[model samples]
Target chain A: MERMKMLEWVQALCFVVVDMELYLDTHPCDEEALAFYRDSVENYEKAKRKFEEMYGPLTAVKSMDCERWAWADVPLPWEGVR
Target chain B: MWTYERKLQYPVNITRPNPAMAKFIMSQYGGPDGEIAASMRYLSQRYSMDNKKVAGLLTDIGTEELAHMEMIAAIVRQLTKGCSAEELKESGLGEYYIDHTGAIWPQAAGGIPFNACEFQSKGDPLTDLFEDLAAEQKARTTYDNILRLVKDHEVADPIRFLRQREVVHFQRFGEGLRMYQEQLDSKNYYAFNPSFDK
Candidate 1:
């Protein structure tokens, strides 16, 4: 449950951080805000990599064990969490 | 930090409609403490958060509310799938059917449309975090009400999960409020307000 909770948090965090990154892209010179944006991106990347590694692939283009099909065994959102 | 990518975190399959569940879950979409109100409130309030951590907290929580909004919509879609006109009338979903005709909308059970009056965006970090704290409790209560009304264990599972999230968010926001307050004055910890000026 705690891992699932952390995964949910990281999923939501990645979305917000990506949004903030876009905001900083326009206003790039704000040193403090930029730092926050950079840190958030780094954290999101780390979390995403960790999640993909621990669990199966969540997104497309990520290579799985099966060579013929990458779309197999899609985990339903409510399956693992709830 | 924010982005504008349109992503569906979960795929909701609603081939058949259950009027009963639709009517019940609709309350969470537009209720006094529903997802729409929560999302609008926090997203708007983040502008006033001077501290980076507080702002980040708002962004994170607010974005989660958007996902919650999707989840509620998914639930509604699943319940309302294959619902007939007669079932809607019999299930007391006629008023909603009249307005949306099987389409999901963001409105309270009492028919009050979503409004900014549901929340505030005061430029003071202390005031904003306090409002957020209260908001989470209100949302948690709403989920509790849903849980009480919903008899289906399958549906209840997700609602229970969502309710637990509200509790966790409340804790995080409480920590955020305390952290923000501490940043203002490590000595004067008992003060109610944490703003720099007055």
Candidate 2:
């Protein structure tokens, strides 16, 4: 239950970061928007770290962070309801 | 230069095995207005785009469209996974089945194979942005068409999400066009390709 919650949090943060990235793309010099983007990205990174420690790395770069090879153990996206 | 991400951008856990629907949805996979073309068009056009920020927008959105393309494949795979031979044929997938044996292929519902001619990489920034805007609308329309026919709840969920993304992308491309225009000569009937002209 807790793992799902944390993963959901991480996913939500990812959504924010993705939107802010595209938003920043068009409005490049908007200082306030940039601040929001930075804040969301920082939180997204933190949430991702927590999720990786408990679950596994979301990408190849973070795969080594785990003590064991948990990279292949994680469920793929198409398997079941995520 | 793309890194492999094990998970999809959006979750697609469809439990139904409806090959008929899969056949139609496959259009969005390889059809003229599909995600594959949308991604390719933006990524290819960005090379000659004069504006740096808009070019970056193309990269980000094009990357996201790849995710959308994957989701479509996942949905089609899940839809066809447990379907029997008769079901596959009855659903009008017999021709596709003979060729791929339930495996995913990039083809339109009408069996037209994916072609690069579906999109263009015209070097002009405004021209490319306008094409992008039209592409997003066409994608949104395709999703809308899919939604009307989709009875399965699991399948409809992500389709709706993908449809909404088209509207958002159109808005962003419009903004990108405006930003590019703002940098050009204000009161002139100049007719020249800014990307190629010095």
Candidate 3:
């Protein structure tokens, strides 16, 4: 998958998970929603892993653990990185 | 309790530098209705919350507001990127440039410095939640104003996303307010602040 397209997917998926989180915070007793939230998180994690593997690093820790200082190489989020 | 992420909530790819747009967008960064104030309001208010659920909501929402703050900062940074000193001066950014010199600072479009006075904790759930709800709307309105005047699609795109997040936050705050109300005595809902009155 294209880096931008994949990154966008990860961002949207992460949003869904967090939105459910806000819902659950207010409606803690909703079992169905909790289940869905877990599923969404699982899906998000998977996509995140794929993006990390292809695009290199999303977190500072991931960048540090690598053989090189990959963090400085990639275009920053503000660069409207393509 | 927070982790750093290398990317923005939404991508910002401004092909053109517009100091004019950056000036307005910076308000959302440090202005009164800005993301920094929004985050501080909720994070500070959560401690006094009697209900755990509402407190959690505050924590989560407060954290998200930090991300929005970063997004706004990125927008301002990108917009101001490569802006020549003369270009900045012509765009009414001369005073700001003289002070910061190609760096970003938290201030209103009108040049008011970012101040804690923009938000309050109140220590009362009702008062705090109402303030939060209003904060979201204010931020949303600021974004609306940005969308109306910003001609660049790259700049407008992320502003649109941030605007939508504000609406969602308002809904959550409304729900959180109800959760807090449920824990209060029905007969004296807004009569007093249980945390403060007692």
Model 2, residue pairs in steric clash: none
lDDT by residue (tens digit), candidate 2, B1-198 = 798666677667787678899999999999999999999999999899878989999999999999999989999999998788889999999999999897988998899999999999988887888899999999999999999999999999989989999999999999999888988887752477788886
Scored by CA lDDT, what does every candidate get?
0.71, 0.88, 0.89
True-structure lDDT of candidate 3: 0.89
Q: Flag the better candidate by TM-score, 2 or 3.
A: 3
Model 3 segments more than 4 A misplaced: A63-65, A72-74
Best of the two (1, 2) by lDDT: 2
Once superposed on the true structure, which residue ranges of model 1 sit more than 4 Å away at CA?
A1-82, B1-17, B186-198
- What tens digits encode model 1's per-residue C-alpha lDDT throughout A2-54? 55665776667675574565345334567988888778888877877787666
lDDT by residue (A1-82, candidate 3, tens digit) is 2788888999999989988999899888999999999999999999988888887888878886678988777667866752
TM-score of each: 0.68, 0.94, 0.95
DockQ-based class of model 2? medium
Candidates sorted by DockQ, best first: 3, 2, 1
Clashing pairs in 1: A19-B2, A19-B3, A20-B1, A20-B2, B16-B81, B17-B80, B17-B81, B17-B82, B18-B79
Which portions of model 2 miss their true places by more than 4 Å? Answer: A1-6, B188-190
In DockQ terms, which candidate is top?
Answer: 3
lDDT for A68 (candidate 2): 74
Q: What DockQ values do the models have?
A: 0.07, 0.58, 0.68
